[model samples]
Target: MSRSLSIIWLFGLISGFNIMITGNTLNYWLAKENIALQTIGLLSLITLPYSINFLFAPIFDSLRIKYLDKIFGHRLSWICLTSIALVFFVYILSFLNPFDNLLLFASISLIISFFSSMQDTILSAFRTEIVNKESLGFASGIYIFGYRFGMLIANSGAIYLSIYLTFNEIYKIFAILIFVYLILLIVGVKYFNSFNVIEEKTYSSHTSSSHLHLSLYHSNTSLCHSRTSLCHSRGGGNPVNNINFIKRYYNHLGKSLSSYILKIFLDSRLRGNDIGKSENDLSLLSFIVLILIFLILYRLPDNFINVMINPFLLHLNYDAFEIASVGKFWGVMGAIVGGLIGGFIMKKKNILDSILLFGIIHALAHILFIILKIYGKNSTLLFITIGAESITGGMTMTAYIAFISSLCQGKFRATQYSFFSSMMGISRSIFPIISGYIVVNFGWQNFFLFTTIITIPSLLVLLKIKNKLQQ
Candidate 1:
């Protein structure tokens, strides 16, 4: 790997870790502060700005800062700026007590979400630019592992720290960590000397060619010199060449888009023929439904239990430290193991089979949570449940990620992946909010049952897509 690519990976780790901590730990803290359950639901709304990032993605794609691109390259400059912003925002959150000023905390959280979204967009684009297609999966895995580790520290370590210190103190420690990360980022920026600068002469030469082509195609005498001059001014001299290049580029782009659209329509027809050819073979659709049902059922138990974990802990007389410890250590560890295993499975088996296996494991994992809920006061049960749940959840997530990765076509990877990820986020955002309400109204046991029921549809969908999923 190039030095610049290595530096970017390092930054990815730091940023991922920080984000995981903030995302996972904040819920526990808020619950401790006596925030209303409804308000907790509203926390999901903070991600609203993230959807907006997709709209402005094109702007980032087109524009680059002239001097900054020279200094740190386009993507790195964005990363550096966003990282600094993130550090400052995280630090500021340490000072405000959410219990005292809920609005202020909410506002801060929104700002953090916005910048984080921007950071995510730029970082993803940068990763694609720096890393080759083959290495991308491994890179994503490493980044996720680092992120999960950060969550463990924030969730478990922060909670443990809170046992001895005040929340303010815990926040201060986290702030210091962010500052250290920022310093390291600055150092990386200085060390990685791989900035790509576009030459002015190249830009001019391309422009001149474009203008000359346009002048020849059109017979209007008045349009010739004026159009050429305008192109020269914008293109910085070689207007004719620039115009031709742009015309050819657009023509190619149009053809590519047309082909892509045709492919989308044709894929179904091809799949249909394949199905007919293999009539004796079990249809992919059936397998997909089976897997989808399994996925829905697997998550159902947690969906129910997750809603009540805070309340149950409080009822059982567990302290913040214990909650944090379980989440950080067990949760983080499970996630890493799960992700790694999922990646390995993808490498070994088809995506559909891997997902099916994940579904089976996921459903079994929920049984542990059921045991914990039934034996609420047993520390042993809690420990077992925590470990089991974390591992299962991690594995399930990893399988899903791998499945999504396999689905992407190389040309439209970013746009398609972004859309798929957003759907995942939508499910996450909506489910938690609904789960919270269900827990409040139906109680934890009933909520678990409800979760089980909801999962059936997801499983059915998965089963329907089984064959395509394998591809």
Candidate 2:
């Protein structure tokens, strides 16, 4: 168990490191070189792959590398390939002058983002495959710890190291670290692949690729039968019968294919709903819709408040150092502790109960911000408020990851989880824009109050679907 958790943690760490290097560290380097602000803004195009990788995520699910897939399992094979590719590109980028080789630098950076995003998708599926459902919450906690630690190194650690090291040297060091971690990852993958003991229950009938293929075959077969019966009734000689059969065949094919592709982006349970009649009509669709709504809303309170936090603190006349101390140092500590506690709860209570408990606590944690507002910038109160917020944020996020992991137990786990994650990301990105507007119009006190109120809908959504999800 320790070994497995270590591997999971390392996966998260490496993912975080690579993403930050390509994003924050690289952007910082560009700025230090006196790149134009407009050009620097355009550099966001390089990281665009992360947002759209779900479009190509199915490739990792269905395609297998020649030699690597035979050695590592399908998911791990893709992970290994992408990891090595990421290291290669990062190392290459270390040698290029961004100003001299602007096109090359941008191309390589985009490739790195592409591979990094692919690695993330494959790693999520791989993690889901290796860890049993019972330990998902704990595993996710450890992963988050490693992820945040890695991000710290890339952001704060790299910035501090810049006093002694050039950007090229930093990139080289990160490339080397990634390579070394790859070796550890290979050993861990081997270890987990050998066991083959952890088995997860499927969430719906359309969970696996085989199930999907079977459904398609059955649909086509049933259509053919129905067409043949019509032909027989029409004396089996009319040209219209054959034309009608052809039209219907293509029509059904289009719908099935369209639904299959649509399911990749929209709700994953759509395929399950379309494939066959459920024991309770509309139950599965309602269940998934409820969960999706919950997922989108569950973390809004946390995210909505977080976007305005630094600005809010600065507005309160707190200096940068004080905010960094509480927000970065102590805040991270609080989150780590909360994650572990969340894991314990998930391990003991059923997931629904655990989610409900976390949801309530998460909502209440927002009230601390209102208190912080009332107390002014006192260090003790700030620490208490930030500490509570971080802890609950961490706990809520861990539960969210665990909850999604539970749903993504299918053959297309990578694609399913990617789509779900993309939805969450969309919510996180859009809500913050509204946060700024609210702070501008309503004042900080009302904004914090609004954040607290926002949690109620998600909690209600969770309760509405609890009985269905458990099945």
TM-score of each: 0.72, 0.59
lDDT of 1 by residue, 1-471 (tens): 656555556656665655543454676677777777666755756665564565545344334556665666556666667667776777788888888998888788788777777776666555544554556556655555555555556667777887788666777777677667666665765555433423233232322211111011111121111111001112332345435444553454456533533332222222224332343223534442343344444454454455456665765667776677664576667666776676566566655566667766676666665566677777677777777777767777766655544443333344344444555555544456665676678776676556555655656566666545345
CA lDDT of every candidate: 0.56, 0.65
Q: Residue 399 CA error for candidate 1 (Å)?
A: 2.4
**C-alpha lDDT of residue 165 in model 1:** 81
Please state every model's RMSD to the true fold in angstroms: 11.8, 11.9
Task: Give, for candidate 2, the lowest lDDT window spanning 10 residues.
Answer: 226-235
Stretches of model 2 off by over 4 angstroms after superposition: 1-10, 21-52, 58-115, 122-145, 155-283, 314-324, 346-349, 405-419, 467-471
Candidate maximizing lDDT:
2
